[model samples]
Target chain A: MLSNKKTTNEKEIQKLIEELDNIISKKENILEINLDEKIRKLAELLSSSNSLEEINNCSEAIQRLAVIIFEKTKALKNRSGILYIDPFLMKLAILGSNIEKLSKAFIQSWRPVVGRDVINLFLLKDAMTYWNSITKYSFEAREEKTIENVSKISFLDERGINEEIEEMYNELERRGGKELYDKLIESKNLSEKIFKAVILSFMITYGYVGIIREPLKGKVWVVKKEKTIESKNPESFVIVVK
Target chain B: MEEESTKKLRRAAQLLFFKSHRNPGIKGWELRKALGQDYTKILKKLEEKINELGLTIKIVSDSGELRTLSDPHEVLSNCRFFISINDPLTITDLRTSGWSIDEIAGLTVCIATIISKEGKTTRQELEQILSQKLPKWKATRLLSKYIKAGYLDEKEDYIVLGWRTKSEVDLENIIRYIFS
Candidate 1:
């Protein structure tokens, strides 16, 4: 019975070494990631190498880091403050290993409020939007690209609520908003119809005017139409929504 | 990698298409009304996926114009392959298309109504008849209605036997029948 007990303990020690080696493989290249003070103390215990108590302590530290990463992702999405969107996406792309249950658990931890379905929907939509913008990026040289896209797209903390509405009013004055607005407002549900009209009118205008983008920040969807029908559909001509 | 993305999108498309078909013969406008503004973009993405899957979508407009009213009712009728309308494609339609009803419903009485000796009805014909003649009932509801009405008999497939009119049964004693 004593010999059997010794063999079981040896097997458990071997399993602990394998788990630590796997964890280190992922962190090897990430040089700046200093272990937390608590984690450092745990590592001191782990230096003894074969102690079962040290293995348990190291496991606790790994669990803590996972929880921290999960919480940080959730907090970033909720409070929008110029998050490095691309880098954030890169981290997300690396998630989900061969283990299905672990990946699901990780996603569940990261997005507590939004369910998996909602995250999937947003990811798909966002991916399409991102790919569309990236297609526009191929024109410029490499070094100047990052500065142009990322640096320009940053937003200020304070902006007027009516600024968006005023921009529309100004554009209308220059390009006969009266004629378009009058027809749009004629619908019984004026408010609802105006929203549709605004969206339609802008799409028509942009289709004629090539949209400009300012990298990492955000890009406008612009489509430039041919010259023939330009004047006939002036409302359908150059439009900028943002 | 692109092929994988295309496959993912196709799976998503099947979900969207099947879900939209639950309301079979649903128009783009009706889908917009039901699913909100995202329907057009969602469908456009699905169409892109279908194209990636080596399928060509010919946008056959009723009139050659910039904008024409799309009749989903007509589209569903004309489209036969991998296409669906607002109504759920019944077990009967699937059976006629060479799928065993048992595959989907398992061992059950598959009840469907056919118009007086018509072997099988297209979705368009069924919709029109259900809406005009049987205005009170919906097409999906007819599965149960015909079953209870004794107009539809269930076996390996749904067989529509003729319905018994009230007047024909009491033809000999009209006065007594009316009084009773």
Candidate 2:
């Protein structure tokens, strides 16, 4: 009679396991399952059974049920304000619709925050005081050796620079209106080559010439600008004489 | 005494409406310092005053979620307060507020995607989802814009709903309207 009872208990535990699996794997709404009752039944079976296999199966089922319950509770907590819709269906709806319609749908549900930003007299006064304090301290000028060298270079004056740039622009135009930067600076004397590069930079800066540096091709070209466009924003780049 | 209370109410309104920080809205402590210890009471009065103009005050907790005034006094004091419209906005209103149609559509896709994924998704996943409806470049740009606008938060790789979304957007209604 005791042996017969053990067989019945084992069969019942197996049945419960199958049911729990079905509920977990097949049901869309986990809330519909009475997971608490299932857990209670598993506990009762676990205590009554002397057989090791039946006890193990019951414990495992209870653990799986407990995990599902925990997940459901967490999901519910996170979704306190929002409703749950199938993610796949939501993606379908979003992808199937046109932008205009989707935007209209979104606006129908959006409540934008509205606030004002004002600059009052106190704020303006505070700003003025801060500015005044900052302006009281001027930036100190630092003397560098480069400044002395630049000062000695008399040809760097703004007055005659424009005419020299014009002459270089004419020379570039005579040479097919476009010449390789390296070729333009090619000379036996290193000083002369450096001087020519300096002039080329001035021409590029004054908008009389444009430099096209193809870093990938390892080449630089100096193209004459058809019109003397004012270089309001000049970009600087280095060209190796070698 | 009535005149004093009225002045405090005006000060509270200014603090809530005028942005004094990088983020919109004023902290509860700042309000306390500016309007005295009875700042919550003043905010209650301000809520009533703004209600007439179809506007309302929103208090968000330090955790970046909306909180009711019924919370503990300490929690309430730590919360941030801002003004928001009482009613839902129309498309025309959004346009006037400087949001382009593509931007509105893109933001909707992003928010909905994040919510559907249990309130968090990856940046790459979001970008891929958005690229379906927009050019890859535009999709990337729009994602950054939404993040900057406080509609979405980025934590390393994950993208979660932001404080602005919590206070302003009706996530339930957005889902319902879209499915409907």
Q: How well does each candidate reproduce the native contacts, as fnat?
A: 0.00, 0.66
Candidate 1 per-residue lDDT, tens place, A131-215, comes to: 5433243433344423233233423111321243344444544554323333322446744444434444433443422222211
lDDT of 2: 0.74
lDDT of each residue in A33-101, candidate 2, tens digit only: 667677778878888899788778888787778777876777567557456566788899899878887
TM-score of each: 0.16, 0.57
TM-score of chain B of each: 0.25, 0.94
What residue runs in model 2 are displaced by over 4 Å at the alpha carbon?
A1-69, A76-82, A116-242
Q: Residue A219 CA error for candidate 2 (Å)?
A: 46
Indicate the residue-level lDDT of A153 in model 2.
48
CA-only RMSD, every prediction: 29.2, 18.5
Strongest candidate by TM-score: 2
TM-score, structure 2 vs. true: 0.57
Q: After superposition, how far is residue B89 of candidate 2 from its true place, in Å?
A: 2.1
